[model samples]
Target: MTNPRADRVRDVAKLAQRSARTRRGLFLAEGPQAVREALRLDARLADDGAPRLVAEVYASAACLERYPELDALARATGALRTATDDVLAAMADTVSPQGILAVCRQLDVTLAEVLSRGPRLVAVLCRVQDPGNAGTILRAADSAGADAVVFTEGSVDPYNPKTVRSTAGSLFHVPFVIGADPAELAQQLRGAGVGVLAADGYGPVDLDALQDESAARRLTVGPPVVGPLGDGTLGDRALGGGANGEAAPEGRSSGEGEAAPSYALEAPTAWLFGNEAQGLSDAELALADARVAVPLYGEAESLNVGTAATVCLYASARAQRRGQRTG
Candidate 1:
């Protein structure tokens, strides 16, 4: 492992290529920040009955000394190995290595598995091509307490190196799905009692309006029956996310209320954000229960998709958290 030209270094370096990543079913997480998160999550996810994501950790002596957590994790998992600085640099995609990197299996879960948790908030990146945008959105989703993120077909690969770097370890914090069908995913979410909202600059529904309405409705008595937004996609009369269609407060309900309080953003929600340049197609927008727009107050033309997603996801997260406490 000391030699930079070793076969292990070459193979690990090859992961920068998508083809190589796909062939090997593994991706490289460069730098200590990314690698540390992977190690932490590997054990945490396992506790939740999900497979461990981190398979191996290669680090320079400096990194292990600088971060004792890494040393402890390696001792526990038996996956840590010391490497020369040159070896780490060879395995990293960045010009300056962070003294460590991780080899982790691509962490993807089935759509059914994700929905079975009855997630309160979710983000769907539809046809977003930029790796940086995708990674930033993942970070935003994690920060907003989104349960999971979905990368629809034509969206950037969730495991891309640039995307991983931009995530700053949030990638390991939140679960994500790749290559999902936008239409099918929408239908599935609707079926699970989650409302699907599409993010569009020209969307008819104002995000602020939805928040105001949600706040105003917090004290209502009857559980709101969620229906289709006349988009001809989801059926009417469906209750928002809950166990067995009953109002479960969190993913698991404790019989807190007879019926769940429903708000536009309080209900189990999946937000669809389109490509950075073209935005969502007509059909893509139509798949949502409603199309929501973040109103721009400044003279700026439009917000970038990453920024828009952050605003939208946080709005939903705030509403959902408040609803949970109230319930």
Candidate 2:
């Protein structure tokens, strides 16, 4: 084993973390599965895992003086802990350090890259700041045969440990992108020829309403409806939200078809979900041509972010599947 006395505090590991932070493109992963995921990341962050033996490590000599076990761990592991307890706090994601962390690079992709050929489905994480919620949505996106997933500006980083774990290994199954600017995103989707849709928990139309009789359809979001495309023209477009904000553009389309024609949900589309605390912003919402929601029969005020998102995306997947069969 390497000797702690021979190692410096600013070794390769610390440098790697600094680089990642500087570039806004680095993450650290611990455990075998997380390491595997790091390797698979488009921006491969690390190939090896930092090992913390059954010893303690202190961030500083003062900390060591305060907590002798931390020093003892250093003696055991041969890795020098930094000089700041706060640094350790930030680095230590768990209540206790696992002694194993893998540094990784972030994969920043564009709209075109996200919507690569294969399927015509899209998952939009508008402002879902909960890392777990974000990751779970990605997992669902992969499971539902999504072509890609888009994360808006205010969303959490998908590489967060909590978020990554929530994915349940779905990170490798599909591609996801980040859209930092709503206006830029709108242009990109329009350029890519991908329809943009938003999820409204209290939307007027049912999600199933996006379908056409002939199997070709726009992306539908909302609850399941009785009739097909354009069947239920919502006169009561009352939206229940004061907790969110948005910056969508004028004349932006959310795939609202004119007049009820036999429509289907087989068209290429992207669906945007919102934050755990608050839903999508008002300005951002205007970008959507139409909105839909799940009809919760129970008296629950609203569903949790994960449950609601799953319902929205799965509804689209189901519509597309049926459309494909008919087509």
* Best-matching candidate per lDDT: 1
Instruction: Evaluate all candidate structures by whole-model CA lDDT and list the values in order.
Output: 0.77, 0.55
Candidate 2 residue-wise lDDT, 111-172, digit = tens: 66664563367888887888887888898888888878878887887766677667866765
Pairs of residues at least 3 apart in sequence or in different chains that clash in candidate 1: none
What overall lDDT, based on C-alpha atoms, would model 1 receive against the true structure? 0.77
Query: Which residue runs of candidate 2 sit more than 4 Å off their true CA positions?
Result: 1-24, 39-92, 96-101, 116-119, 208-263
lDDT of 2 at 227: 24
TM-score of each: 0.85, 0.64
lDDT of 1 by residue, 13-125 (tens): 99999999999899989887888788888888778988778888898888889989877876566788899999988888889988988899998788888989988789999
